[model samples]
Target: MAGKDRQITLRFLAEPADVNFGGKVHGGAVMKWIDLAAYACAAGWSGKYSITVYAGGIRFVEPIHVGNLVEVGAKVIYTGRTSMHIGIDVRAGDPKNAERHLTTHCIVIMVAVDDEGQPTQVPEWVPVTEADIKLRDSALRLMEMRKKIGAEMAAHVTPGG
Candidate 1:
């Protein structure tokens, strides 16, 4: 979490439609949740509209079954011209289990856009706390990895979208 943005907390509940026949929530569903959480974090920091432009490492550590209460937290870690890197941590709080389990973790990059839908520069967000620093460092590393993967994917892109 970014230092000044410590006031951030985004929550969402896992629903039936989010689960697969296997009874576990689908990874794509979780990604959607992360996207929303990251957008909220970026919006909170930018105080304006932000759109996701890139996505970093998305790792699923545990299964989130149906009826689980999913709590996701996102915080801005770094900022560029108009882009902000936000760290997303998703946890599943099951009534059956006494402790919440970490389910998914990812870093989503969002860019503040103008009304015309072009990327626009925004103020940089500073990390104020140790936690924020740690998260930011992790996000930066993940960002590098994502860039490499993106380049690899681009090299294989065909004429089709």
Candidate 2:
């Protein structure tokens, strides 16, 4: 699919209800937004209902204030037989002005699913631009790191303890 067709952006205002005790938007709220954006991008690219299988490297770089204009952008960076790696960026700024700063970033792995909830194949995503190529490479590196981290954790942790 073309790059433009494999991306989605959601923009909205951060509300007071989204604020945490620290006077900024709650981390959970931000994460929910990220998941929603990633789902939209993955489903759009795959043309099937997509479910988040994994989300990692979620960095809360800066606080998002109430009333700030929040933007969540998600793009398909890589594709496997059934999964799509979505890169998500969250930015926020004063709604009155045009400036926005990156507030969070993460990588989400979404798998397309059939009506029965079984994993379904998705259309392959090809990198066409320099940015796309770089993002795809980054996703590949993250996948490798995830494997190593998972192995290390499994070795040290017990199922019930």
Candidate 3:
């Protein structure tokens, strides 16, 4: 699949404050970067102000450490009438060892809004590459997975008598 039109990259240096006692980077910090990067990508795609309505399926595969350089990549993956799905990938690098790592992945949903702060439909996106296809498929898969999980949870939640 081809990449999105406006891919954005954000890089930051991990500090002691950004990591946990175990030397692993804090999940909260990663989450914050994810949201920020996703916001930028979504806004770039929509060309309008947007607000995050949902952030789902943030999975951390590896722990990052202080002194590592964290790189965040953001892209617009899907679009609805007024909402867009943004995908973020986090990687880390240890300059001393010349090693790079993948730490986390996440997706966030944001909606475009009008000047009055009401939800507004976005213009049609022009997807021109295979990466866009991959992004679209990934978003659809996550959405379906969330829906199935929600249905199962609802089925198991017995109403109080």
Question: Which lDDT values do the candidates have, in the order given?
Answer: 0.80, 0.94, 0.82
Runs off by more than 4 Å, candidate 1: 1-7, 95-98, 159-161
- Across 1-161, the per-residue lDDT of candidate 1 in tens digits comes to 33245335666568899988788999999998888888878877776689998776788999998888788888777888798988788988876666788989877889988889888887777677898888778777777877788899998889777
TM-score for all predictions?
0.84, 0.95, 0.82
Clash pairs for candidate 3: 1-130, 1-131, 2-130, 2-131, 2-132, 3-131
Model 2 clashing residue pairs (backbone) = none
Local accuracy of candidate 2 as per-residue lDDT tens digits, 1-161:
52247888999999999999999999999999999999999988988899999999999999999999999999899999999999999999999999999999999999999999999999899898999999999999999999999988888887788
Report the C-alpha lDDT of model 3 over 1-161, residue by residue, as the tens digit: 11234668988788888877677888998999988888788777778888998887788999888888888998777888898888888999885665667889888888989899999887555566897887788788888998889888898888993
Estimate the lDDT of model 3. Answer: 0.82
Off by over 4 Å in 2: 1-4
Candidate 3, which segments miss by more than 4 Å at Cα? 1-5, 96-99, 152-161
Q: Could you tell me how far off, in angstroms, the CA of residue 56 lies in candidate 1 after the best superposition?
A: 2.1
Look at candidate 2 and tell me the lDDT of residue 35.
96
- Candidate achieving higher lDDT, 1 or 3: 3
RMSD of each: 2.9, 1.7, 3.9
Residue pairs in steric clash, candidate 1? none
